[model samples]
Target: MPPRRLLLRGVLTAALVAVVSPFVHVIDFFYRREAEGVKRQKIANMRDLTPGGFIYFSYPQTGDPKIDNDPFRQFVLIMTEDGQLRVYSRVCVHLWCLPSYIQTRRQLICPCHGSIYREEDGVAIEGPAAYQSYPTNALPMGKIEVDGNGDIWMVGVDGRIGYGREWHNIKPDELVRRV
Candidate 1:
């Protein structure tokens, strides 16, 4: 190779690295940093949720109107038989399609590719999904509290009032009683 050509190639490579490194660092920084200024809203009281049942709620903490702007705002709350409560994002790991609960199967089934997730822990039971589970956003359950009136309050991951039934809207009355 000619010396001039080699020198020009080296310079171009160095320039590309210099231009790309900062952007990569910035992306990494954002990914590593925790979401700030999030608001909380309580969607349901512990008493309201029956064991072995699940509640569907929206992200940015249920009911918050601001969550409507989030393209990825879907979530579910599951109350296990052991009284443990967990929240999960509804996006399927296989192809990022939204999954719906299959009542007959008692699991969340991704319609796009037949992926099944355990309602209890969001573990992938079967299908084309490579990940063992769905992705979950940070939901601070510790701040959830109920008032004397039995109303639920929760702090949402996003900085907004957790409001609305469209996301986490399953009411206790609507669920089929577990035998």
Candidate 2:
């Protein structure tokens, strides 16, 4: 190759590296950082929980209206037919659309893309979410425990909430727009 062509190629390669490195680091930073801990919030009482029914609630209670009321923060607590309690975030993994619980069907269905997930464990059963890679295809879940007093408290979320791979990595402007 000509010396001038080689020099131009080298310059372009360096420029590309320079422009792309920062974003790579930023993405790496988000992936490496630990998730923000969820606040232990009492969500429902077992005595009040009806079997095969659903209860809606929110988590973390960040106090910032944008974060607190963001649709992604919404969750559903359900009492399975076997009497086990499970909680799953309402945010659909495919497109961040809220999935509605169909009690009769025992599944969470996303209206946006018709993605369906098992209500028992938030596993994507069909549609686009089912076709995505692991975890991305699964809905975000919150860990809950029931105390002796029958109060159910949400202790933590299995993964970051919302549209992205990391919940904390969501764009602030999107949160503002969502709110």
Best by lDDT: 2
Tell me the deviation in Å of residue 145 in model 2: 1.6
Index of the highest-TM-score prediction: 2
lDDT tens digits, residues 1-179, model 1? 99999999999999999988877666566551322214555567667787777677664543457764353566667666666555555666556677776655667787888877766545566786633322221122222435676555543332111221124424332232212
- Per-model TM-score, in order, reads 0.51, 0.68
Tell me the TM-score of model 1: 0.51
Off by over 4 Å in 2: 1-35, 62-65, 163-179
Candidate 2 at residue 108, lDDT?
Answer: 90
The residue-level lDDT of candidate 2 at 173 comes to 18
lDDT of each: 0.54, 0.73
Worst 10 residues of 1 by lDDT: 157-166
After the best TM-score superposition of candidate 2, give how far the Cα of residue 178 lies from its true spot, in angstroms.
35
